[model samples]
Target: MSTWNRTGPVVVEVDGSAEYLRIVDYASAEALRCGAELVLVAPYSAHASVSPMMPGYSPKAPAERADDALRAAVAHVRHRDGYATELAAVAGEGSRVRVLAHAARKARMLVVGRSRSRGPQRLMHAHTNLTLASRAGCPVVVVPASWKPCLMDRKVAVGIDGTALSAEALEFAFGTAAGREGDLTVVHAGLPAEHAWNDEDPDHSWISRADHLLSETLAPWTGRFPNVRVTRFLSSRQPAAALVHESSEVGLVVVGSHTGALPVDPVARRSVAAMTCPVAIVPHHVTATDHERISAAPRRPARRAGRSDVLTP
Candidate 1:
């Protein structure tokens, strides 16, 4: 089998930026646990081509650039190898999206960096990471530019709502904790209610159910993974804000995805947006159409501090 196998290959888009180096450490650790390998598909795409915009442009420079990056990135990763990896660079046909899309095929997941949002420009052009996440055949993981988190060995944190889509997160958290030989913590954030049909104060009901679900709905999971820890938080604020706050002390944070759902709902959108830690998004289910819209969109670079996209930066 390829070094990057059917399991999590951790296809990371490497620009060879100092900021992205942490991915090697994170990937190596995870691969060791899952018996998977780490792979590097460094797509070489340059926006500064001086040639004409037409179809017959020369491919030499871009091809060579990719080759160089692949050699360098592979060397760096090998120096830290904890798992087998396929280190190769691809000259993205027209855009970076092409190569990343290809890499996403049969790979466990995609991890990319987030451009600090600048303003309207960012909104329109978008970031390559979001593009991949929105379009990849599998779930895309966005690691912040300066993100570095510990491995999942003990204590787990996952966000859950009352929906079936949210339930997928439990699998990742459980599997991760088990791989670590440690405990698991499952957290659900929402306003509470009484019976399935009963209506009560959302805040009061949410807190009540948060405790109840841990004891009831997740009872079987507790037994499945000994030393499991769970807490339910009532959230009335931004979903991401609540998750971020609760997960600050955790090694890894998992959030379920409803990316291809009818609306792509607000929760899933916030789950991936602006998160400063390594994140695993379990997309409930997705289709090719979703990937197309995600990859075809153009992306602008991270804007300067004064840009409109940043409110407080």
Candidate 2:
């Protein structure tokens, strides 16, 4: 679990792309809802990207591009009644992942935009987001590039793996559902290969075990978020596929990612790429119990000032 204070600012990336305004809108609303400051950061490279054919043409410097992005983002936020939330914009000089991770080091959460790329591009994009989430030390909300406000935005879903790994994710899901004043759906997906079952028996032990796990994992959160209606779904499909299916019906999907020096898990990578709705990747520390539950071995351990500094103004 993240040790940073949840009351910190809500940091968001401002890339000045087609989807940037929408991302800013989402971040602004989250900051307003949480009563925290909304921070906009634009990361730029040191050098300019000049094309060979455009050698005679002078393209804007990276610093200038970053400033422009931040300016536009600030205007967009203010235009949407974001005056109530404290706002700050920073133009940082570095890689996107580095700057964003630094900016959100102590943030309540980091909000970023997901590209609409497919195939290898999609996988690479998802990998970058997951990398940022792992290093961010806070939850990372990856909003779909095509996302727009709708009635379904009120519904939220979370995937639990029937272990302590999902503990922090459950907390975030319940809180988000309560905040939206919507329903929460808990999905637990188990593959047949992972479980042993009798072909003749109609009642599989895995089903009962999954049910108990969901109930036990959700007990405290359910009591805390009484107003958020909860629904349980146990599926035999792949974990990532199950969450992606749920994403179509909900506004947000929350899933946990193990934090360590190892590579990002396939489940999180696939779900984030495939989900149609916004996905929140909550990073939690992998515990000994998690290893025992999954029969896995232990793993090794493992943003955002503008111009190398984080400016408030």
Candidate 3:
């Protein structure tokens, strides 16, 4: 039998980097907050990349390197102010996404480190994150390698359109904010071209419409999490840019992505690349196991149904 639980441990990727302690730190804090176990995963190939052109390429066997990485992460967690949230480390042999997805089959959430690589390298890295998020069957958090503990760590923001796509993301954002005892910022960015201006009202009308949309979307969550303060922001800026801007002031930016066949929207792709803080990519759909868990949770109150000026970018 698999160790997969509907509300399982928080699984994080351990990439064998000397700086990966930061990733471990963030994940461990999240695990502690949710009272979930923290499982560190390191994926490596058994075969070493040996080449005749460069015989010096052999550093160490991939398995050995993975073991070393897991050991270091375990030690880091153990030494962190006497951190004691149930922890486990696994070294799996396979591709990155495959191993991590399997490890987090039905986990509470999956966390991974984001690469700062630019140009083509950055695109490739983003694709991997997207795939992982889709396959993990749980929320996936991509934390920047440069992330450090800061005052903004408690601040969380999420992007939403007037569609079901953002429903799951909203839930994650509100839950996270509640856990941190922090405020939640809800951003709705609309393109000027998408709306028609009238002589009766121009800028103010669009702003009002956006505000109304956010109010409707957030009604259920606000009632459920009465303690979480919310800030509604409406802007004419591009969706991706708007999210990236908010990321500078927030610890986490949550965005919804389509699961299965559909690719993540362009806004999510761009935000992940430019965000200054960690980004949580929540899929719109959930696995059967997750449905079982959610079915038992408190049901959210229904909201007034109607579409507004929220663009589905």
Candidate 4:
């Protein structure tokens, strides 16, 4: 049966790299937090087209090799953490990206391990991570290999663009922060205002506009999640750079994919290459209906554009 019919597990991709075991650890913790099952999938490519008369052919089957790897990964997880959550192992066929993307269709989230590589090697790895983040039905959390198990920072950072998609990112960020009892930082980056008056004091006027937009965007979520502490950050840097800088201090960074409208390659590449924390790429499609419903509600009074007041929730 297709795993898609069920909806209780957090799927993780495990491979040859020992770093993947760390991914299992993070995914397990996330599964525990969500009260869901953890599934470890090891995907192997089948080389059926290879000629049998090759000079250096091995007799062992590809499925057998894949099964062995999957079993070892499961054993490693059991040895390290003695994880208590319900777990399963599957030896899937096809590319790792394809298998994981298929599994994510019914999962709470798809977790994958990323390691630092250079040049074309880096691009290859990024292609897989990017594919998963952009195509997965659920959120994709790309955890860096260098991440260590430490005391939770209790902070979640999210990038906001004042778009409907950003609202989805905010919802995920708020839920994550609330669950972890963490503070949420909403970062918005944009160019200076076009008007000369506002341009002279962009920090005052431009920042105020960004703050108002963020507040208005988060107003409904603030009501829904009354306990989540939120702080607003305004920057003139590029979105990717701003979020990446914020990622350094935050436990987790959340971003919206905007139904694939927003380019995720830059963040995905940087996250794998150097991010200190796991990055959650939450696509906006899943929350589109909710956004529409919220939009149909009574509108709030439009806040004045040039107020120096900061937004607090």
Better candidate by TM-score, 3 or 4: 3
In candidate 1, the residue pairs with backbone N, CA or C atoms under 3 Å apart (3 or more residues apart, or in different chains) clash, namely: 118-309, 119-309, 125-299, 135-291, 191-206, 192-205, 192-206
Estimate candidate 4's alpha-carbon lDDT, on a 0 to 1 scale.
0.69
Estimate the TM-score for candidate 3: 0.85
The TM-score-based order of candidates, best leading, equals 2, 3, 4, 1
Cand. 4 TM to true fold: 0.78
TM-score of each: 0.70, 0.87, 0.85, 0.78
Residue pairs in candidate 3 whose N, alpha carbon or C atoms collide under 3 angstroms = none
| lDDT per residue (tens digit) for residues 24-125 in model 1 | 556655655566656666666565476577767665576676666666767777787623654444445456777887877766777666666755443332
Candidate 1: worst 10 consecutive residues by lDDT?
Answer: 304-313
Q: Which candidate tops TM-score?
A: 2
**Per-candidate clash tally:** 7, 11, 0, 0
* Predicted candidate 2 versus true structure: per-residue lDDT over 105-149, tens digit per residue: 899899999887898799889889888988987889999767788
Is 1 or 2 the stronger prediction by lDDT? 2
Q: lDDT tens string, model 3, 35-117?
A: 99999999998778777898767678899999999999999889983666899999999998899999988798999988879
> CA lDDT, every prediction?
0.56, 0.80, 0.80, 0.69
Q: Candidate 1's error at 53, in angstroms?
A: 19
